[model samples]
Target: MIIWFTTLQIVVAVAAGAFCAIAGLAGRRPSDFSVGALALVEVLLIGQIVMAIVAPFAGNPPSGDPLEFWVYLVSAALLPIGGVIWALLERSRWSTVILGVIALAVAIMLWRMQVIWTVQVG
Candidate 1:
């Protein structure tokens, strides 16, 4: 994966996670803003998936297990939507916290995916 794009994904995941967490702490429900933030992350993640497809043909195949890479990619991409669905169903303050936690998980998973893709670190 491209380093800059991966970094951006991680940052966006973390930022969105933190935003939902703060809202949760404030006793607020899952507002549209937070959901929109999750949507933005979802879009970026989809872009990452598309880039993954394009990269191999462009001569940037995965250095690790491609199966694992793809699984992580797909799972991470779906997580936020799942979390939001759960939040809407639960309809509790803890649901906001759950969204925050789910967003954080997306961030963490993206970092792991980068590592599996053999991202070089500073």
Candidate 2:
């Protein structure tokens, strides 16, 4: 994974996660703003997917097991979707917090994926 892009994803994910968490703690219910923030995170993940597809072809293949990288990528990509679904179904303050937690988890997973892509040795 590209350092700059990974950094960007982590930053955005953390920011979004914090925003949602604070909102939930303030007794706020799931709103468009929270969902939109997650959508943005999802968009970044989609970009990461594209980059992952191209990087190998561009001679930046993973130093670790490609399957491990892919599993992380796919799982990270699903977090936002699941979070949104949970919010929609639950429609409570806790759901908002869960969404925030999911975003944070995504951020952590992205970091792990970066390590798998560039640091870990197979």
Q: Pick the candidate with the highest lDDT.
A: 2
Report the lDDT of model 2 for residue 52.
Answer: 98
lDDT digits (tens) for residues 34-97 of candidate 1: 7888888899999999999999999988888888889999999889889878877777778888
Q: Score residue 95 of candidate 2 by CA lDDT.
A: 90
Candidate 2: 10-residue stretch with minimal lDDT: 113-122
Q: Tens-digit lDDT track for model 2 on 31-57?
A: 999999999999999999999999999
Report the number of the highest-TM-score candidate: 2
TM-scores for every candidate against the unseen true structure: 0.93, 0.98
lDDT of each: 0.88, 0.95
